[model samples]
Target chain A: MNQKTNISQIAVVGTGVIGAGWIARCLAHGIQVIATDPAPDAEANLRKSLQQAWPSLEKTGISPGTSPEDLIFETDMAKAVEKADLIQENVPEVLELKHQVLGAISQACRKDAIIASSTSGITPSVLQQGCHCPERLLVAHPFNPVYLLPLVELVAGEKTEPAVLTRAESFYKEIGMKPLIVRREVEGHVADRLMEALWREALHIVNEDIATTEEIDAAIIYGAGLRWAQMGPFLTFHMAGGEAGMRHMLKQFGPALKLPWTKLEAPELTEDLKEKVINGCETHAGNKSVTALAAKRDEFLVEVLQLAEKYWPEPQSIMKK
Target chain B: MNQKTNISQIAVVGTGVIGAGWIARCLAHGIQVIATDPAPDAEANLRKSLQQAWPSLEKTGISPGTSPEDLIFETDMAKAVEKADLIQENVPEVLELKHQVLGAISQACRKDAIIASSTSGITPSVLQQGCHCPERLLVAHPFNPVYLLPLVELVAGEKTEPAVLTRAESFYKEIGMKPLIVRREVEGHVADRLMEALWREALHIVNEDIATTEEIDAAIIYGAGLRWAQMGPFLTFHMAGGEAGMRHMLKQFGPALKLPWTKLEAPELTEDLKEKVINGCETHAGNKSVTALAAKRDEFLVEVLQLAEKYWPEPQSIMKK
Candidate 1:
């Protein structure tokens, strides 16, 4: 829908962590950003986040002339998107609130302006309800610390135009993001669903008292986690099968699928299990706070990402350089 | 059992990929290695793998006097373990073969020697069915490119001495491995089961034709895969939940586990799906061969592992440094 419209000026609604991350990413790409949030301290928080994210984001590589000074904030929703080429809504997950906010933003934006939601699980169709121009609404979900990660999943609603999807895809790519066009709408989208499956299994492991949080983390961090960083389960298995690839792997170990390793439904998060999980996390946290761990994670992530780009260079990233 | 045994000389039975990997890792760590295999081309393949692995292993870091020339392969298992203080058996996954080979290795080695089976899924209890001294036997599973990945899951069987587990842990650590002492022995051990679950889900996605190999790979490499590089799902979601941690996440969306996103039973890998998967992989492979991808994976894995060591700073790896 917005394939041809140049998204030079972008409006980001909701200055939560996700929204602040978006602002940092956009600013790093040299985009003029206008952000809006109702929270009393939203502007200050956004500024703090940009400062915190600057060091790692620089490591991720920024466009020439990128600066934090280009960012501006407004409290009024209509005033925020008054001149926006694109609007990225990052409000809470409540469906009704999202619908109202999206509808209001649509009323403020121009006909060609693309409006996207950063909803992790909610479908784009639901977000389009009561919007003035439903054809321009879509989902452009991204991970945390959005400036570092190259992925951005774009999901199109039923009322959305195919042209708009293409436009959004091109725009996202132009900004140095890898846009994964999810084939169909699902509760958690593709990646989150797969993650949820693993998450449920992890919960089952801890809930059953079979292993602690630390053991589960070790089971991944020291092993499979390393592999997944570069390849998915499919290609990974294809490699694991040796020269023959995925077919050989399927035939050899297909029967193991029947094993009761994963829980289809999540086990109840009982008080005891919660306590054990909390204690386990505290033990593993050691002297590092969550913030420290997150910073370390981000630092290594930038290194890993830079390493990835070396082997598999992307055109968009190259364009920025 | 082998707590005090001087593991200067190591016997590697069955010089397949896993065995060659173990040999490469051991030799790089400056351990004297003797390997045995019955296959006519085993020696040639092992030599080639050792040559292929050295460059990356060197990047992983090596001891003062480590060299490929220190590796010796024998045709007879008894001669191979003649002076070995540690024997790593990597025979095929066949239970009967493992029983025979492990039993024979135990008979040849000293009573204090530790025998480790590199069985991916088979239980140590089953592998130790007819062993001479099962007390010194346990499972020490490592991922592919074993020279780089720091993880080594050590699982104990019924007859395995608790002290032997501790000894194996220390020995593995001495060799620059992060040995995870599996609290209890189960099928596929701990990491493999988690990997298998993801593997099965991947197979299902491919079988249903929901997404191509490249898409599924994209879904992972760009998304959940990033989080996995440093922390497992428990820790990842704990961070995702903001300040309240895992409890907040569990309470927020624990019910999404019952969604139809993941198939409990892997869809039958029909001929069509196999062709598509192979074709998809070929497409994703682009102009590169599996061998090429593997080499690149290893190169990047070495970098990732090195970065991980910098943060975690494992004693074994640091000892070599």
Candidate 2:
């Protein structure tokens, strides 16, 4: 059964970076958004963030009848979820907080309304623990600057129903998003776990002073990172193996895996390592602040993704495997 | 000592994909190239490859006085190396063949002429063995479509002189390439090691039937892979850590790494896995041939890199860190 009609409106709880981005995206897609946050100055700050992000969305061309003014700010939790077809919980990553927030939203929204959490680490099963209807609760994790990047991992908890996942996927697609459904509820889901592996190795490198932060980034931004933006490692190796393909590459390079090459054990983030890591990033930052760097990152991220869409066109066709 | 007066011309041996790419980039840079290969149709094939690659290179703005006619082909190894100031060897990965070709090229070129090998795995130390003026031998490994990607890992062997490395760096910079000088000899250098780690993990996923090749690619292209193009894992984590930074993230996520999240062992490439891998790529590739995909890849690569250059502006400035 289609639990709700069209996702004409969205309830966004916690107006932090992720939540605000979701609000901006929904509003741009012509969905009325009721966003709530208890923090002081939350309304003013969120409006600023939305104003900053709106231009990028405008470039992508927002839905008809959509405007930043479509966003409604609410401090009352019950009022926020009153008329939403879907509610996305973007509370802090603490489990108890998510449980409380998700429970409240589930109780207030339509009995059939789907509730999704943006928790990156905690499994949805745990977040749905005290909700009114756990079957309607699931995880829909989006990358930062959520308005830009299309990847959103949708993890259905053990209690979550299959229909909710299908409906959520369709709704996300409606909002111009690519939703990857993780079959199993592993910690960090699929994308974050993969990100964790490389991140840990990166920490080890900086910890031991094998390379400075700048050198490490250079190795990627110019080399393997370029290939990653368009394809994952498997298809790249298939291409790199010349005519013989992946089998030949595996046979020849398999032995190196056993080498003590990349450190899996993350070195302690001691004060010394912290200074080095921070300083290295500061140097790379040059004259810009983190905010400036983030602005620049958002700008490039959109351009690169647009180019990727133009080149690959149909990410879903590739995801069909 | 200045290794050579100037890099007026380059001698390219082996007309494989890597070699042809090198020729195209050089010709586009307005450098005269004496290219040699023994394959019966080497000239015709090289011309066809260059013709296909020219449009992309032209968009990058070809150098003044550079034309496709500048590529001179020779079947005779000594004649090819006679007038060149630099020799780039792209022979097959076999050790004996590399030794034979590099030694012959060294004997033919001027004593101070720099001879660089484009070996992906083999270390420069072994390639220098039995070569004339072994001090000039070094590994300048480049990514595929060598013309488009700015990364070139310059590895110095035991016998390679320090000044040769400096001169090579300057020469490559003048030609508009980013060369990363490896501090010590290592198999696969830095870039390939990172690529290999991710690749080995990808193979495991497919082998276990956890995900198809396309699914694996989707996990990356739409997710973490996008982050990689501009920032590596370290800085990205720095941002992900919120106001607390990398230490906070490491403390939060360190324990998850101990779990078997990503496979360290390279899965045996069984026939079943190979068929699955190949089939996934073919489907993703759709109606395009490998050559067609390569063309599409090249077009987007140049466009994306140009966009990246515009946003980042000075990869060299960042590389300075």
Candidate 3:
């Protein structure tokens, strides 16, 4: 919708949940979306999802002239992508399927068209294989409910052109997204790796009966979850270090890395790693002191706590039987 | 302040960050606090921290008759805990220091008084080893900025009485907390385990140069972090699975657990673990269908995204140089 981005037409190569979400988000932004899926009921399902998502999108605000009718559905992948300036592939996670689909999309789409995958786990370099114009392919992984959440991780394949990433970044930003360009290609990208670590540990806890799903949910909704909404673990720990900030935090709690706290093995707290963490936090804090940052955090928490109370589900009794 | 809980005077056994947070939260609830610390400047630091936390607490809501002056300071741990209905121990994480401090409080405090440790890692049973009346000692771990965050993980030692947990739960609820009674005591308990897993993975990402801390934080704030404020991972994933809910989710993404998505090894997703997770999500979902829950989540995300934009830091350019 931003006239400068020059990406008015987007091809959505799958119409499942993530695909449908992408379609709805692009449509809400007044971008013409040509969606394709092989499933018999894909169109009906996609329409239902769009109807469900539109109200929330409307509340959030929509690009002028935006409407669900702006979207067009096709059963043929080649037809769906041939004309689009950008093709967003949201097919299943199977590697063979992705290679086959991306290959088809690459061959059929225009030479300059950008190819982005919504693959959560596969590395961009791995996905770039078997694709025509591999330099145009990159990973633009988005979280669920694509229309509302602003984060979209942009990872470049080894063969990807920097210009392609730049173009993709601007286009996503114009659609109201925060594009985080990953430094290197890795399995699960950035967000999913962090989430999977937590998920794996959570599975361990459940398997061991340390807590029920409800109790685990309570643990998050009421505590760290609230803080994480604003700050990541590093910044949170920096504040926890008090006035000295992360310098004192690493000194104090760095020993806990050796403790059997999480099943995941922590990277050795080498002097280099320590400096990286402390420096990263100090840099992120900018000119603000830990006290000043804590004040801002406190103010934010007060308002968010109230906002959350209105929306959070009723507290389930977590008493041990 | 809730007359039914029968807890009025609370002794804070340390005046560090966690201890000061307890003092501020208790004082905000109109509960008289007796705080003690051996450090030369403990009282001054505690007072300063209380002043910093009070404004936010006031904004959130303060109990009737709440007064900062209601608190008294003592140099001796025994003196501080004596005559108090509840004693909160927040000494340094050193096991020896905690054992010594907890022992003194236990010997001096009322037999019926509840003794809770704010220890983030050490198990309650380990701390109770040197204490008199170990039945009263329990771990009541709270998150940072304790005045606002509502979650408190309560873990009881082998010697602890069931009645103590019951009484502690009511007291925490009265003071505006969601008490998650951990089923089994682990090194870091429930919330921290989840957090530590994520933190460890984040550190690996940073160390490996996959992303910087700011990029990692952005990954959260713009996506999962927004959702976590209202729903934890289980319910969030349930909605991600579409109308079929968590059952469909497990069938789809369960294989990712076997993939090297995270450093932490996932537990074997046997039939039992799968059922536990599926059943837990269903029970938590109650009668609400996944579609209904997704709608609620979408609504919450819309409002939270707006709220977060006001408080979130200006987006740092995460592009690779």
Best by lDDT: 3
User: Which residue ranges in model 3 land beyond 4 Å of their true spot?
Assistant: A315-321, B315-321
> What is the fnat of candidate 1?
0.38
Where does the lowest 10-residue lDDT sum fall in candidate 2 chain B? B312-321
Tell me which of candidates 1 and 3 scores higher on TM-score. 3
How much is the lDDT of residue A35 in candidate 1?
Answer: 94
lDDT tens digits by residue: candidate 2, B11-124: 999988789889988898877899999999999989987886676677656787778888999999899998888899998877899999988898889878899999987889
Question: By the TM-score metric, which is better: model 2 or model 3?
Answer: 3
Count clashing pairs, candidate 2: 0
- Model 3 lDDT per residue over B146-188, tens place: 8889989999999999999989988988788878889898999
Each model's lDDT:
0.70, 0.69, 0.89
What docking grade does candidate 1 earn? incorrect
Give per-residue lDDT, candidate 2, residue B22: 93
Error of 3 at B195 (Å): 0.5
How do the candidates score on chain B by TM-score?
0.81, 0.80, 0.97
Per-residue accuracy of model 2 over A125-225 as CA lDDT, tens digit each: 88878788899999999986687666788989889999999889888877877787776776667776666555545444444434455456667766667
